[model samples]
Target: MFTTKIIAVILCCLLVSSNGLQPSTCSNQGDGNYGCFDIASQGSCTEVSNQPASRDIRWPHSGIDSNIDWAIKCGDIIAYKIQWFSGGWSGWYVPGVNDMDTKVNNGNGLRRMWSYFYDHTHSYIICKTNDSNKLRGCQ
Candidate 1:
């Protein structure tokens, strides 16, 4: 029984460490409270706003999900996009003070982040790509 218990505890520890667990910090930014999902892992990345008003949080992965309330102020035409290993790009999402969240999936979570510039016609173009940053296994 002692050996079994020891093995179980070791396995639990390994699982926790391998899952890329981390702490998150939240604060009020710009118009409302916002944060960055900072992820340093094998195949995931994000563009985190490291400002005094912004906060930091661990990016979600398989079986783990996250919801974000983008309190976008007027005249700010910025949005976030994500790309997966197999699903490709997920286009820009203008949360615009709405609640946006990512779904849990088997893929290596989100792999990329993109900034968009919205035009008068309600269309947007890729304005920036955080290509210089790469996660653990992301190319």
Candidate 2:
């Protein structure tokens, strides 16, 4: 059993390396910067319906079992998070309210990110990681 576990770990490590799956750490992250789930920094967005920079409104995926290879991990919540990788790992966020409001924060929330960034729909621009950093759309 121990041997099998060791082999599994080795294989996993090998796969991670061969598959470009980076092994990042928050150590390099500067001080005072929020960690993966910095719920405190989630201040507010001047406007929720902010326009999208990346024209591809169908990219920068979310949820598990998705096109994980091409997608970069952005922010994460409890059950899941948005994918927005950057070589290894640029870092992560805790994600804030869907919309800056005391009432329309749920499904009513705008499918945009902080400011006018572009986060697909899962969260918002706080987690944009599309190809070539396309922020204009199918232009």
Candidate 3:
């Protein structure tokens, strides 16, 4: 029974750690900084400045411009800020909000906003960050 309890505890810890239950210790690079990770390599970090300067919006529709290419994937944890044409910013959506508000809210609104941004009707990509520098991406 003792052995089983120990194994259970160990499994729980592993599961929590893998799910980002632990805090991230990665260092911040300040504003206007970008961290790069090789498309082929994993567990490494670098800096890249070649990201797109601005994204075009189609107005009636919401989505990113077809010409623009996103470096990260859908499930990939990344940082982004919400911009409005009226001249306002919504702050960085780290972990895409769903991961952040897992327990508090259902994250339905955040998910919708993200979908709108992805569709390209809103604003452009101002800045972004990833988790290459830390154990996980965009923690």
> What TM-scores do the predictions have?
0.21, 0.17, 0.27
Off by over 4 Å in 2: 1-52, 58-115, 119-139
RMSD of each: 19.2, 17.1, 15.0
Model 3's lDDT to the true fold?
Answer: 0.39
Candidate 1 clashes: the total is 2
Candidate 1 — which residues are off by over 4 angstroms? Answer: 1-77, 97-99, 102-139
**Which candidate has the top score in TM-score?**
3
Local accuracy of candidate 2 as per-residue lDDT tens digits, 69-107: 123323222122233333132123333433222333344
Q: What is the model-wide C-alpha lDDT for candidate 2? A: 0.35
lDDT of each: 0.36, 0.35, 0.39
Give the candidates in order of lDDT, highest first. Answer: 3, 1, 2
Largest lDDT belongs to which candidate? 3
lDDT of 1 by residue, 1-139 (tens): 9999999999999998867333356544656535555543223223433112222232222121222222121122245444443535455565433324443334634411221111111232212223454223333
